[model samples]
Target chain A: MLGVTLSRWTMSYFAAALAALLAGEVLMTAGYGFPSAPLRAPETLVVVHVVAIGWLSLLMCGALFQFVPVLIARPLHSNTLPLPALVLLLAGLGALLAGFLQLAGTLDPAPPLLPVAAMLLAGGFALALYDLARTLWPAQPLPLPARFVAVALFFLATTVTLGMLFSFALTTGLGSRPLLAVAGAGLPLHVVAGLGGWLTLAAIGVSYRLLAMFMLAPELEGTRSRAVFWTGTAGLALTVLGGVAALSLDAALAPALIGGSVLGVVALVLYGADIVHLYRARKRRIIELNSQMAVFAFAALAAAAALAVTLIVLGRLSEQVGALVFLIAFGWLTGLGLAKLYKIVAFLTWLECYGPALGRVATPRVQDLVVEARARTWFLLYYLAVASATVALLMAHVLAFRLAAGAMTLATLAIAAELIRARRLVDVSAEIRLPAGAQRPHLLMSVPHPSP
Target chain B: MTQDYLDLDVRPILRDGGEPFEKIMEAVAALAPDQGLRLYATFKPIPLFQVLGRQGFGYAAREIGGGDWEVLFSRADIPAETAPAATPASATPSAAGASDWPAPVQEMDNRELEPPEPMVRILAAIEEMRPGEVLSALLCREPMFLLPELEKRGHAWRGGFEPDGETYKITVRVGETGDKA
Candidate 1:
């Protein structure tokens, strides 16, 4: 087995992503966004961008930098490119947030930051997409996981391009009629492409491989996995088509959206079935805590889909859109991200600190790095708070939602602390750390020294 | 033409993490001139082929279910036609062109194992091997995650799915710098 080399900038990306997540959660708890402000208000846009680009996008990119190699059994196109991409993304996000503040009149006479942010973000995403594409190109007949990532990258390009168009239209004030129409009606399309296609699809793909590897289950490259990919792709395509139609004020948008939603639901059902199969067929009798906790995230996905369908059937979807998005963003995506990070942080730490010494020394198992008992409480609390928040949003209970958000922030902080402990080798036995060859890795960055 | 044989089962010793090399050697020394040795172990005793090959033995190996392998080592000087019962078509050393790549120093049945474990075992085994030594492994799937790591560590490998199209067989040659750890 070839070893998975440490992606030098992955931790930094994770660090920035976590900070963004905390910022979003804190903002919500403080009543800065959404229900307190109108959905399309500048304040709401700031919170949305902070979470969408700053947190989820960064997390996905970071994971891809490390796992894409494992997926295709190839190294990244350039190890040196990731740091610059991160910097560009962060800078772009900062400018975008400030630009939103300027639009809200919170900042006086700020430079027209929208177009500048747009260029920076486009450049950043371009570098990332190019690096990933080149790495994926030579691996012909890619495995199922790599194929998912490839499609996801395509959507990411769509997402970034659409975003840039919106930014330019907002800043330049010389947009074409169609372009202005897109900016007016394309927000849903942007969210669908970014959240559903780029982020969720990539998460599904990576999770398939990671769960199988962690659970000792057989890889799911069968008909079910193929169905998941095709259906998911087709669903996204139809949704994007609907988005385009909406931009043109065409009557076909409604049917296309409905059809796409149905297909997307079908894909989710198949994916859920595949996950059950994986868990049932796993060879490891006693599964780890991370895998166990991920069930909550899966359940959230199912619940969110079910809620959306019910809302549509009851003709209340427009009113409850906020609740649905909240469930999807926090309950599904963020929940899964947090659960996986619990394991990935420890796994990468072990690889960085002990991978070279593997087979030569008595290094600790990956499970030995974290106190799951302590983290378990935090994970449970986090999910409960998300659930509460979703219900409160549906009931339009602003205070209740804020309270739930505060609990979520606290839970996230506790889980993050546990991750930091794992990184610092706090839970690893003293004997394992005190050995002659054991080196305590730097907290947030990998040292460039060659393997001992 | 039928030779007497000595039987040895080192599965328990291997399972207990004990080295069975000295015991295997003692059995070899005690073998009668007209006798061969029949070895039964949990995995194919690949390194032992060269060890016994040096002592003038040509071996025939066959999987005997449940990850166990039976290898019969007979004197190579005996003509193949005369030792039909013991010399199967897969007999090592007697097969032309196959002898260039030395018998693997370590053989692993990673077919039942999961990901990372197979990678872990193979990497650990290679780390213990001397430079230029070869190790063989049978896996349930293509060793995708392990191959790049091998290349990273300067080891060389060749692999393909077996006739069954399910089992993947790989042979890795440890590089000069592979054993640096």
Candidate 2:
């Protein structure tokens, strides 16, 4: 049956993300065994990669799989490839996280597997890109949000390639004094690709449409919206290129790094302000849990960027700076991502099951899927955990850090459980069913809740 | 006689937006003595279409394709002739001017004894059907933009083509009862 197949890309991405989460847990647990040294450790790098590449990357891809069609005003390009793509990404993530965990240990079997796993992940992404690109390719002068997503795909591709390059370098055991040190140069490139190009840009584009729809505000178009896209795009490109050059060419690229960072910081500030403006202008007075939690994450991101800029100017990218960067990347960016996922999963399930019956018959509102009050509390607890971890990491308190990690794990698990409940996968089917005791309300579709 | 209504150009003056709209409205306002101007404008949202109806501009709006509407407007404040004329064309005053209408709406002006086939195609599908049936076809990818012509002819309905997250089946109905299911 040509039904709405579960998106292969989404499945794969989620699988990888779950594997990464498990790896993070394992690394934290292992910390208890190896308590001598924790800073700049291999295990730490493994945990970071698991969260960055494995977790967040998948989450973004899965979301795009669902949301892109809605944005473009079309059905998904293809439903056929989701399962294969999901399997490939899941297997790749499994191998990749395993390799990282092995590398973290004293004796390593991770080296050989890294390149293979990278290739598999890259292949999975490539297939997904092709499918998504089909949706965008035919449109003349693609819409604002879609354009951002299209361009972000390129950055995603670049990020994957750079990730592979780093894996190759590690596998080959390049000396500390190599002419072109891929690992050293590629780390910042990965950060740029993920944080600026993929997450920030994609998030802005999505927020423009979603926020407006949610808030019942005017469309986020016209000159200022365009400026946000171009400025953010240019800034991220410049910063990534400049940082890469600085590493490869020493003082020769110092000017580029300085200029790029400034541009990047400026763009980020504008984006932050824009998000705040959107929230402020919202017609809905009471903010939902996803949006409310996202505001703190957004603030943390902007603050971290500002702090990083200051530290870089004063030449203080020491362990403390690294810890802060970790918090922003994982705690802020990933936390916001998780919060948003809770809403998205529920919303999509509603569309799949209840969207068709809106005109013909009565259906339950999206609110019926989950309890909002509980969601708000979970979000608050998640942020609390993030804040405590950040402080513990700063103070170099190992015991406190572990406890905070446990708290984060609990919060994330709770949110994931809530997502499953919202989806009601066990209950959803092709049959056009109505909620119990429902009458055909007037043809007006109730508005889905917006971000704060 | 068909040639007379075939050339009737409609220009609506938008409240104050652009030439096409405003000119169209002005053209509609300046109807020939004893002749009504039929203005066709698509309304994708039924609520907005109904709002226009409440504002004294009567029309017959039908969902022809996608979420698009084909609403028909007349210069007079009265609703567009909802029921097709049962009498011979020679007897109806508007039928005498049917020849002056645009080609598509006037294609059947020669045979006034029967309802305009295109108008019949548009209105026959929607009249007395459920609101959901009307809206299902309205929101399709290839929305019924021609529905405006129907509204311009003076039909009324409740509600809009809401994105209620519902899926409706839209297809060509082959019978007079307007039953698609």
Candidate 3:
């Protein structure tokens, strides 16, 4: 194989993340904690962290490690960082899961591993951040996407710090005042920082570039992109500041929180409009399946936003925040991840196997690497299951959530299988081949052929 | 410029500054294998040099009068010192002559585009290119995916990041390596 410029461990990140996603989805389907699982219940915490840290964060980190250099036009400062980080993360996740199970009384003598796990996870993230930050440093007047990612990294560092602090207080029994401070002021602020500032903001930044480029439309470098960036930043800033004030001074910053939430919504609207414009402006007349399905992910985000606003307006915000989060995580964030992954796998596979064969003889295009006709149906099924599961979880119907999760788990596994097939160059199973003197290149059974 | 060859004066048709690119191309294609093409333009036409050169054509140019450049593109096979242009400027009622200029290679930028889109666009453009044309793309990173595809199709390519490390440029010539590779 020709030497590839991408990070050596990049695919390992994807493989690890996908494995975690499958485990997390299966956990949800198992319904071990059931109706008794409150938002803060140890079992619930296990599931949340499994999805957030183990799956989504890992996926994002892998992608960023690969794309950050590409985005900033710099070679990675350190290629070795991912291996240690991956090891630390997976190890920390195991410890954290055990600690949570102990808290839930499912594991006797689980040994207070939260603080230890927290430190390991923090170490892993810190190392990852160092590599990304170094790459970003040389690209001054950073592109809009890089700008967003920079802020998201800062938020991620903060999120991990706070989480470690929480674990430290619980395990070591020190800093009682600070521990009480955070617990009293509420931990929703922490959740918001991770989900809103770290995850969503970064996703928005990445998609801004990806969507426009993929659609063959002009980048949203105008007012709309700026609007999303600034407003989203301001909203997150307000929330973080308010959380600090509440924790330290015991002040209730309700009005500031509301103001922040409204600003966040405004940012979302601008971003949504920008995306719609991109779709309309696309020169590629036909939309591919991955992009077509990503529309639903965006719609899911919009729906979640609308629900949050309605709950806030009706004075039932506290009661419904959980449901809104569910929608955002499973419906919006995971949906986008799945949709994008479907295409990304095929692309990476093509690069691995057949990239240099272009314009030479007959070679399969990237689209041909994907069995989209089969995978496309899975996308629909996954989204449908997500919607049903979201509604059931919101309605607090345990049985319904379980049923929907089962369907989702199955759909996810089916799609994942296709990804594996593509990665291994098993598309040869389709028995398609391109003959000599072909005027146009298209998909066929992708057997790896050495470039002439 | 010295009138080494005034067999075809395209100056009248170029008054609108290469008004019809198609017409310019048609005048080019009309040149017989033994003949050459003379074009009058206001500027250097530097990009066209590369475009036509890839098709086994070479040119010598000199200023005619008042900023007009008279460029004579001829088959490189012709002994350059004596071969001269012969087509009349008003070779009129011209149907769009097949483009004699090596097909213009399309250039695209796919920096920061999601994976596969860049690959998709490049492949699509390559499929549509006529023989001898090239396509150059500016990318955010080295297109690791494109190299193999190019090799398998027998098209040759070379790329490297620009001096500004962020901009990567790759050039692919369709059907053959031509001279650029």
Most lDDT-accurate candidate = 1
TM-score of each model, paired residue for residue? 0.84, 0.67, 0.74
Cα lDDT tens digits for candidate 2, B1-181: 1111112222232222222433544554565543433444333223323323433445555666644445555335555443222233224323113332211111111111111122233343343233322221222111122232223223332212234322212222122332222
Clashes of 3: 25
Lowest-sum lDDT 10-residue window in model 3 chain A: A438-447
Off by over 4 Å in 1: A1-4, A249-252, A447-449, B1-99, B141-154, B163-166, B176-178
Question: Which candidate, 1 or 2, has the higher lDDT?
Answer: 1
**Cand. 1 TM to true fold:** 0.84
Model 1: per-residue lDDT, tens digit, A57-110?
999999899889888877778777988999999999999998998899998635
- What's the residue-level lDDT of B59 in candidate 1? 83
lDDT tens digits, residue span A75-129, model 3: 6677788889999999999888888887888888446898889989999999999
Q: What lDDT score goes with residue B37 in model 2?
A: 36
- In order, the candidates keep a fraction of the true contacts of 0.57, 0.00, 0.17
**Range of the 10 consecutive residues with the lowest summed lDDT in candidate 2 chain A:** A443-452
DockQ measured for candidate 2 = 0.03
Q: Please identify model 3 stretches exceeding 4 Å from their true place.
A: A1-4, A34-36, A428-452, B1-181
Comparing 2 with 3 on DockQ, the higher-scoring candidate is 3
Ranking by lDDT: 1, 3, 2
The local distance difference test score of each candidate is 0.83, 0.56, 0.72
